[model samples]
Target: MCHMTACSLLSYIAIAWMKMVPMQTIRSRVQFFKISALSLVFCVSVVFGNISLRFLPVSFNQAVGATTPFFTAVFAYLMTLEREAWLTCLTLVPVVAGVIIASGGEPSFNLFGFIMCISATAARALKTVLQGILLSSEGEKLNSMNLLLYMAPMAVVFLRPATLIMEENVVGITLALARDDIKIIWYLLFNSALAYFVNLTNFLVTKHTSALTLQVLGNAKGAVAVVVSILIFRNPVSVTGMLGYTLTVFGVILYSEAKKRSK
Candidate 1:
């Protein structure tokens, strides 16, 4: 939960900063359409992703989360229609292996859960690549906050109905929104905020870093999230799981080093 809390806090700060920053005019309908469509896709991804979480174990979820890089790689390649080096392809091996290992053994192989996770991963990956492309093409015109301002309103539209039906009793929810529940509220708020930041950061990072490096570092998020989840939830930490997490982190470090050397 602390991991979630920290992520949430960072997200909130990002969102707040986005609000404070002035945005350029939505000059073209095409840009507006792209933002709306992409934001909606992201909203759907989050909804499905959240639902999948209920059926999947935390370890499984984290492992699936770690697959984002692979998905991102695939999406980026398809979008760009560019072939990457052999080392880039090889890097995915450790990432996949680490995820399988860290998932507390093999996943249960639930079709629905697996599908949801896969869809969520693909959606997120596509969104990242699209956002990167947008940022690259329109860097001066579209600031980070502009992306948030555009995305958030669309997210609210997508999330509001779901919140009403799935998370009904807003009054009760509001009542429980106390200091003790600060963590939960913070997490939700920050998660929403971070959703935007992650999109923005992906653009910046991909611009500055290699795709493989961005992906590898992104995979580490799962390892960090898992470790944090284990500590906070007092989960049983198995030897295999520890080994897997270690490998995942190591792989990320290697990928980062490779990027540095290449630069």
Candidate 2:
């Protein structure tokens, strides 16, 4: 996360240097409280997401994560008071049910890991809803790049203290590990570049579309994650798990269709 946020900040600075956008404009006068809140949400989503991987199989993790739209609707109403159509709301039923079934059926499920994944999912939803709320006003509105330009550093600030407290001697341990394997540095550099793009595109998507729409698109990505996890990692998945994921994805498709028809 440290590397990811730093890369995002530096990359935006490089964009400013290239005269693509003025540094001054990138440094928009967003409310301090809003940015801080956003950073905290971003940190929770990412930190808990990584933690979930340690205890759950990648396939099962994506299955649980696929229910983002369900949480998004809850947060949307709570934050923005923007209610979906009754039919659209109804479509979320299977989305919720599938995750419950999947969690029960997952052979590698850890109670703590499942909680972290659910929290991460909720944080992502909250972030999406909060992004829409905080950045919507004409006076405070920022384009995707400028918004990220502010968010990345704030995330770094919010995460550092927690990281130090939770992972004692992390700096020394990482240095020792790096000494044993210089390739670790290269891998970090590579992933840092990719993380910037992932974050950039997320903001871009949310900016162009509704927050729920962003969650809908995010839910669709789970199929690919599941496929790659099976192919590369050869993760064991039970029949119940596959059926549950199928039901979840099917429900998401129905929700998308309901959304389009409503529009």
Candidate 3:
């Protein structure tokens, strides 16, 4: 929470320093409401994502997140009446089945983690869809930096209360951070900078492509994360789980190819 807040603060400063244009791009009531709603969804999604990490093994968490493409497709279709290609739809089959199989076999599975991850995934999909819709209009589109400048502060506002209510070790964390070397502070600042860049890129992607595309990209990234987890964490995996993960990666690739052909 603190890190996110810091990132938002820095982004605002950076935007101002770069003279990124007027901060009044969110000009109308409807735009304000839409941006606010997206911010709230973003806050919940990120909070749940971090919370779920506490209870889930990194491997399982990434596996579940691979399902984001499925949720993205559903939300995009429902929200914008955007129809996916039949082949793309069919590819979702293995994407979902693979996640289920892998999750079922996960040794570190916790029901709470499973639920939180699913909720986060859904919220993330909704956020993506909203960003795509709200930012698609050329006349109303805010540049990626401006979008983040607005949305990040809103996210901080939305998340602060949750942080105060849910975080019990605030004082302990503060003291620990205080006692830590200055290097830790630099690391945190570096991480916050990276987070800002991530937010910028995410908004740019949603602005440039449909939410479904972003979600598909997420699946590919999730596949890479899964591989990294397996390598770094040495997670024990069942044969079924391995097959499931493999299926998911290939299915995502196929989905991307199918979407391109359809386009």
Candidate 4:
């Protein structure tokens, strides 16, 4: 949770820096609102994603996140009226199955955790769809930097209150930072920089790739993050989980090939 919060703060700072650069193109209030709303969805998703992480192992969390392509397809279908091929639909089955298998037999299900994961996935899907629409309509007017700038500060509206009320020790940390916790300050600074990079990558990826493809790649990210966490944080990794990750990677590669051929 702390990691997620730190990431969020970093993302916001990145967005703010992007927004500072003046752009010749102008957006209407409605378009700006849409972008802002999308940012809010992103913020909410990260929060829920973090919360879900507490109940499930990091491996499980990433496995579930591997289903992002499935959610992205759903959202794209609903929002853009984009219809995926039957083959594409079929591809998700193995991916989802792999996630279930990776979860190590659902070790004592937590309803809230499951819900949070689903919410995060849904939010990510929605963001993809909405962003696609916005970019298609107004992309020429908005560079990635401008988009980040507008989005970063707007996210603060949601992040600030939530962090203040929900995060117990956040206030103390903030005070300590003010009082000269150089390490904490450094941590926060580094996190903020990482957040910006992630956000930038997200925008670039979404702009260049299909939403479904981007989401599919997101699975790989989850798997990698999980592996890193396991090695660094000493998180448990079961045999089934390893097998599941392998399957997911294979399925994602197959799906990517299919997408490329169709294109």
Which candidate number maximizes lDDT? 3
Better of 1 and 2 by TM-score: 2
Task: Please give the clash total of every predicted structure, in order.
Answer: 2, 0, 0, 2
Question: How well is each residue in 134-203 modelled by candidate 3, as lDDT tens digits?
Answer: 7676666777777777887888889888888888788678668868765766786788878887877888
Worst 10 residues of 4 by lDDT: 1-10
Give me the runs in candidate 4 sitting further than 4 Å from their true place: 1-26, 138-141, 174-181
Q: How close is candidate 1 to the true structure, as a TM-score?
A: 0.75
Off-target runs (Cα >4 Å) in candidate 2 are 23-30, 169-181
Report lDDT (CA) for all predictions: 0.66, 0.82, 0.83, 0.74
TM agreement with the true structure for every prediction: 0.75, 0.89, 0.91, 0.83
Pairs of residues clashing in candidate 4: 10-192, 19-149
lDDT, model 2: 0.82
Q: What is the lDDT of residue 175 in candidate 4?
A: 76
lDDT tens digits by residue: candidate 1, 102-159: 6655434456886787788778877777666656565334665456556566666766
Using TM-score as the measure, the top candidate is 3
Sort by lDDT, top down from the best: 3, 2, 4, 1
Cα lDDT tens digits, model 4, 118-147, are 789889888877777765664434656566
Q: Give the alpha carbon lDDT tens digit for every residue of 1-263 in model 2.
A: 55657556666766677655555343354465787788899899989998999999889889888888888989899877899999998888998888888887888889999999999999989999888775575766776666777778888887888788779998788889899998888887788877787777887787777888888788788878987898998877778888888888888899889999998
Per-model C-alpha RMSD: 5.1, 2.5, 2.0, 3.8
Question: 193, model 3: CA deviation in Å?
Answer: 0.8
Candidate 1: what lDDT? Answer: 0.66
In candidate 3, stretches whose alpha carbon ends up further than 4 angstroms from where it belongs are 171-174
